[model samples]
Target: MRTSTTMPPLQALRAFEAVGRLLSFRRAGEELLITQSAVSHHIKQLEEMLGVRLFIRKAKSIELTPEGAAYLERTVEAFRIIAGATSEMRRQTARQRVRVSVLPSFAANWLVSRLADFMLKHPEIEVELEPTLRLEDFASDYADLAIRFGTGRWEGVRAEWLMNEEMSPVVSPALYDDGTRFAEPKELLLQTLLESWNPVGWELWLGEVGVDIRRARVLQLTDYNIVLQAALNGQGVAIGRMHMVRDHLAAGRLLQPFPQIVRSEKIAYWLVMPQNRRLRPGAEAFASWLKEEAASPPSPVC
Candidate 1:
């Protein structure tokens, strides 16, 4: 009997797949949760094993070689099949657990509350929620489905809308109490704090209200959720995503003071998976459950 030494490492295959799909090692690193150097090293070891060039590196970007491109397509399919089969096997035993990745704010404010309903409906299947801002490669990251917010244009992935998020201005009770007059959107520029995640937000909001921002008191923030917290603490008025702020608004922690607004460019939350990937039993169950959840409220965009 002879032992074979021909099998490839899964790590190398994963690195190659991620980089080939994204066409950039830097981006692949973000998805894989590894450094760029680590990505390169994995690809290097893989190339050494196969004795072939996998990627053509340019000054600013990377392009997959013909072999790498062909390999990734098949490898991605392999992962999907494996994930699907494993989930199916677990489902037969009535002990299936699904992994769902979503943004932090959504996990805390929206999905966590609704999860109980899903569990009650499908008691056998357990859902594990992972909060992340970075999108994961389902194959490598072992996530069953990803609830992501974007324009829904990921290459090689299928996306279904979960909900549309509308935007409005929200402020703490103190801001209103301090007599900061936001009689008009323009007046907001004079006295209110423009808490921003991406700088374009204020611009977009101002454009919606037909105000050109010459200058404003701006507090640059990294996360929109943080801005929301700051607003709740009476720090400033932050632009709020309507769905996430619904509870706060209802509870009087935050108030929508004006009707003048911008429709968010941040349109929809989508459940995304690779188009070629075969969804596992858990993944399929979770997707269906999410669809049901999205439909129950009958949100216009879901």
Candidate 2:
């Protein structure tokens, strides 16, 4: 029989794991719904039981000692295995769910519209969508998969190429009506330019066409979706991402005024998953579906 003296306290181990993962006793306490003093006491007791120092205290912050880092890796993996087993047992008795983390703009303009089809096809699997600008940690239970806009390179994850990013000037039909054409790129300097989080698209395109952006009237917005909305309202011209605006352009809701298309060198969409981690069946299905969807041809430009 296992004796109490031979086994480390589960509470202390839990506290230590949380502190090691977050590198802050206060944060661990907050997450565990305990007091900072309690968290420190648990860590101290854990270190004493293990006969090793686990953290290096600093003036403002703390860091895991070398021994703590090694122990953390094993502890985290153990927790992951336990969580996986629990999830598997639950899945065996209930519908499987896949948690997907995605960028807000992509979720709003691209993925959400097609989700109904996925749902119809895979009735056994449920999907939870988490849309945020912040990246998800695959090591945690944050998400099963992530759709990220990047260069297909992230540490500890396998990034499958989704699609290349292309941008061009788009305007509402009202702005393009009356047979009004700006023959010269410089003529656009007189029109309102809608700006998103990063105004690099407009800067790049204007520079490529030798147009000075200093003369252009700019309306800055917080999100790409909002910028597109403004453009749809005929308020200004927006640098539209091809993938996001293809349907709108095809439907005559938006029009590409300029023929020049700019390709982004540093950014593209990617399907990301944890490296060497076995994906749940639900996640695998979603990934396969996403690949098929990406391979399909775009809507014809109207």
| Best-fitting candidate, scored by lDDT | 2
TM-score of each: 0.64, 0.63
Model 2 is weakest, by summed lDDT over 10 consecutive residues, at 175-184
Question: What local distance difference test score does each model get?
Answer: 0.78, 0.86
Q: Write the residue-wise lDDT of candidate 2 on 9-84 in tens digits.
A: 8788899899998889899999999999999999899888889999999999999889999998988898899899
> Residue 53 CA error for candidate 1 (Å)?
63
lDDT of 1 by residue, 1-302 (tens): 55236967888888888888888898999999999999999999999898999889889877888887888889899989999999888659886888887888788877899888888877888888888877767667577788887677787678888877677788888877887767777777765564545555566676778877557777877656777888888877777777788888888888888876566546678998867778887779879888878767633321
